[model samples]
Target: MSATSFAIETRGVTRVFDSRKGFLFREVSRTEALKGVDLAVEQGAIFGLLGPNGAGKTTLTKILSTLLLPTGGRAFVLGHDVVTDAEWLRPRIGLVLGGERGLYNRISGRENLRYFADLYGLPTAERERRIEEILERVDLSSAADRRVEEYSRGMKQKLHLARGILHRPQVLFLDEPTIGLDPKSARETRKLVRSLVADGVTIFLTTHYMFEAEELCPQLAILSKGRIVARDTVARLRQLVGGDRTLEAEAYGFEDSEVSALRRLPGVSKIIEEEYGPRTRLTLRVRTDEIRPDDVRALLPDHPELEVKERRTSLEDVYLDLVEEEAH
Candidate 1:
């Protein structure tokens, strides 16, 4: 697709942070936060980015949102270059870096929204009206006049979101939007995200929640060790990890020779071993319908205590497989 068709795009985007340490602060230590990362997010779509802690998710989000510049390549938001056209992109884009730090603790939530609205250059005639609408949309109208320091974590998150979309941005960047929310609050936050999409907003979401990503994002990319390890729909990602069908077997232990035997079974593509207290669990990724849980059970007939189960491969499985591979 063309540049204008995508709300966010990156080419060979890289970021390296150099810090001085030790005596006289002469020692230079380098950390590569993003390495040759290339990505494209379609307009009006919710694109989820999944990664572990310190995996460059925040670094890339900062770059795309114009909060920080890349060290090596280019990034664009809504067809505008992040580095060269940052001023133009800022108003068209909204960001909720989700936390307690952004809001003013001394003032009321309504006052916080008013402050941000002024910064976004909202028309004075419509500023109060817009703030009220946003407060209602995020279900925070009743608490709008309350002090921010007294707000719950979830309430603060909603206010952060309220401030983000108050300017009616075309693209929104949400970094761990539901990180510390209670279950009910997280669900409500997700519902609000859907409503924003319905209003023609393209969202770039970076989250560690697998269920959230699966539920909200039709397309997702996994970033590991500062690189795009995989990018696709969850269904396609399952195939990449191995297959949808997964068989798990547990026993006290399995001989190395027995594991090799399981690997030779028809449709078995990958085997992961894990230890649970006294028992050892072997998870097999199977690609064919011909292989049944009983089929796997027959191989471990020697272990009378062996237990076998079958289930579908989930997004968490795909994420672990890809991220683990990158770690090696």
Candidate 2:
């Protein structure tokens, strides 16, 4: 693919860290944070990266945003090489890392943004104007003068986003932007993200919230153990894991023969067994309407307490199935 076609692209991008343990006799250990990750994101879109903890989600974000360099392979933002053309990429990209790290607690919200605006080398004449605009955009205008130390968790996160876009970056990297936010704040943050995309900024988001990714990103990649295990739209991902529908059967227990019968039923592609105290839950990935709760009940006649249900396959189901498969 042409480099100019994608807002962000990577080929075999890898990062490894080595650290020594012990005080006197130290032994060096290596951890591979990212391994041969390849990705492509279109401009003016929100691309979601979902992964478990320590799965290199943040590491990839840092590399794409030019904050950390990859140990091997290449990365590009807006067609500029992350390693060789970092200087050119920096001014056009924005990064809002997760948590409370990049802000000064002693300063006001507006002051925090002013500091970042200056660092971004925004046009001297338009610096204050841009800061105000960003604050207003992030809905922090009323709390502009409040010290960051006193700002709520949500407000601080908004300030981080304001600082990130102070220079009007074409591509924004949001690393778990709503990690610690309340439901209402998180909803507002999601709204803000949608607006940013509407304004023509490409967003690279790493989020643990399955619903958030499903809601905001039209395209998604699941990263596990530093590798891209799956990349596709949510609907397609559902099919990859199983199908569009999920059938769940719960009872105290099931005979081996009963499970085999369910597996033999038409449209049943996969069945996952789980034990909960004295009861067991069997989850079936059904691809067709041929299998119903009554059909499952007919197969397991011995269980008097059997309860069967059916629902659409959710993104969480897809994520867990992929990540767990990678783990083994």
TM-score of each: 0.97, 0.97
Error of 1 at 259 (Å): 1.2
Model 1 collision count: 0
lDDT value for model 1: 0.94
- Which residue pairs show backbone clashes in model 1? none
Tens digit of lDDT per residue, candidate 2, span 1-328? 2355789999999999999999999999999999999999999999999999999999999999888999998998998888888888888999999577778999898877777788889888999888878888889989999889998888889988888889999999999999999999899999999998999999999999999999999999999999999999999999999899999999998888899999999889899999999999999999988888999988988888899999999999999999999999
lDDT on C-alpha atoms for all candidate structures: 0.94, 0.92
lDDT of candidate 2 at residue 307, scale 0 to 100: 98
TM-score (C-alpha) between model 2 and the true structure: 0.97
Quote model 1's TM-score. Answer: 0.97
Estimate, for each residue in 120-166, the C-alpha lDDT of model 1 and write its tens digit: 99999999999999999999999999999999999999999999999
